[model samples]
Target: KEEERLRNVDVIRRNGRALGQIIDDILDLSKVEAGKISIEHIDFDLSELLGDIFLLFSRKAQEKGIQFSIESTTSVPSRLVSDPTRIRQILINMVSNALKFTHEGSLRVIFHWKYETTDQFPRSGLLTFQIIDTGVGINDVHQERLFQPFTQAEDSIARQFGGTGLGLVLSRQLAKLLGGNVDLEWSEPGKGSCFRVTIEAVDSAESSQSVPHFLLSETKSASSEDEIVMTLDGIRILLAEDAPDNQLLITHILESSGAEVEVVGNGRDAVDHALAGRYHLVLMDVQMPILSGHEASQELRSRGYCGPIVALTAHAMVEERQRSHDLGYDDYLTKPIDSLKLIQTIRLHAKDQDDVKRENFVATKFSSIDSLS
Candidate 1:
């Protein structure tokens, strides 16, 4: 049975891999199309975010023996109120693609603050984040279509390097979401490529971002810092997933949050468990074999399963997301499952569920009094 389960998991992995790519394109388009993404101005370290990104891509670069370099300007804001996650995503995709295409030589990523005006809106000075890579640069003719959804430079590139071609499109969409744009400055064949992302700068006052500063203590030494737990603790969660590997991955992530997770393999099972079990919230996987997440959620609604149900899917399109909401899902998560984002989603939805329960309880109590009449 264990071997059979493993074989089934392997098949799901293969299927999920292909479907995952398709889902990525859908989710990216969905987020952009639904206007779900918003520019959140919160204090955070730009360098730390960039460093995290660099650390992430460094492994990939080393695998190919291609030197990956990151140079930041002295003027670059150490702290800023901007969406760092999306920024990281854009760079990772770019760097990953660069590393994939470049068979030889080094890939360098330089960051400098450039105050420039765009032709679209005159007199608007913006700060640009530039990513320059020494790899197989794109050709002139395909440049226009580079940012188009699910389009690569050529079929050969897609075949050579297995990719969905959604990376550039999603990056561009994310840039636009932040009131910025991703532009290809130069792409010379056999040399490399440079992509510049420009965004409106937040003032220094607005940029007083810090990294997880609350954990620091006045009486603490560096030794205590290692002992102090940085993770969230004792979070109770209900996870809905059909794929066994995905379920395990989600379980691992939730566990890192110090969460107690109960897992189900389909949407109906999700709704059933949610209605019957005591859980803080539900992570609903939209596409499932037994019952679609949407249908299960509808059933949950009819059965009065009023806890938070966050839709998790590979599809990143607007209509699909709206449908998730319409079907009574409280929140949405797109795959390749961002770890920090999953935690953030949990925090937000947990708060939302509290608010909802309070409201519902008050309404129910009031209705009981009205019944006396």
Candidate 2:
């Protein structure tokens, strides 16, 4: 009974985390549509990210009795300078979409680079991310609006698949933002589909570098059985949220990461409590009664509170994010907070004693739809 209970807990945890990611993705689509999504150019191991992704889907493929594999040419660098998060998301979206259409078949991921010279960056390569899947291929008629926001192939397919159809759209937009585009390589109704994305990239000379915190090892081989795998141990967090449901949800998310958290219902109390106590970070909800999150952050900043404070945004609008930055919040996360990303953001900002925030938002000139025609 005890073992069953533990298994149930783990299942719920996994499902909750997955649902949170879906919500976060939907909000990201909204931001993209509003031209608020920022492309972050950070150096990361591109190959390692793909390896981890393959490991993640390996089990799913086994369950379905489908073959899955990954391949990359040596010309594709080990490390790259670009937005690793967006790139990974694009791959995941494509692969997941492929899996949905495929019943019993094979999935293969191929990566390589093409020599390219652009106006702004002459010595750049167009990294090709090719996803080939033996799935129910996209018909040419339906492919016209394949990358349109809130679109799917057909209503019958939408009902069967049950998706908002944002994945491919977001993937295309993200690739274009990185100065590349998604191209349909080949497809047939019965054969399969091959979708390729080309994005600008430059090789990084360094090998060992920072990785995404959530991209962690599956198991700790060196540690003892009783040892905790991961945690936010000894971290004190202050949460300023007025809504009861969100307060409960956020507290649970933070506490699960081994953080000691205290909550306040309004922004005024947030300012008061934060001033009187010590905390490593603050999760400030942007909208609160009596005083807004931006106002509270302003007050704390005016009083010389230099600690990391992250805003919990709902709208995912440019103005809201800008206000958060202008009013002294170091970073932000949209509401219905993703547990993994919440912890990662806290860990990221917690280590910052300096004023290093996400890179400035860079808007690309080309549109994702433009690449279709």
What TM-scores do the predictions have?
0.57, 0.65
Top of the candidates by lDDT = 2
Off by over 4 Å in 2: 1-71, 75-79, 103-108, 114-123, 139-145, 148-151, 188-192, 204-236, 257-260, 268-281, 289-291, 299-307, 338-373
User: Tens digit of lDDT per residue, candidate 2, span 1-373?
Assistant: 9999999999888767656656766877787778877777666667566764665566566666567777765356667777776787788788888877877778887777665757765656778878898888888898887877778888888777767678888888889999998878888887789999888886665753423322222222223344323356667888999999998998997788788899999999999988888777789998999999989989988997766788888766656666667777777887667665677566554444232222221111211111110
Q: Provide the overall lDDT of each model, using Cα atoms, as 2-decimal numbers.
A: 0.66, 0.72
lDDT of 1 by residue, 216-312 (tens): 1122232332332224365578888899999999899889768788988877678778777777777888888789888888898788666667788
* lDDT value for model 1: 0.66
Number of the top-ranking candidate, with TM-score as the measure? 2
Off by over 4 Å in 1: 1-15, 30-37, 114-125, 206-249, 252-373
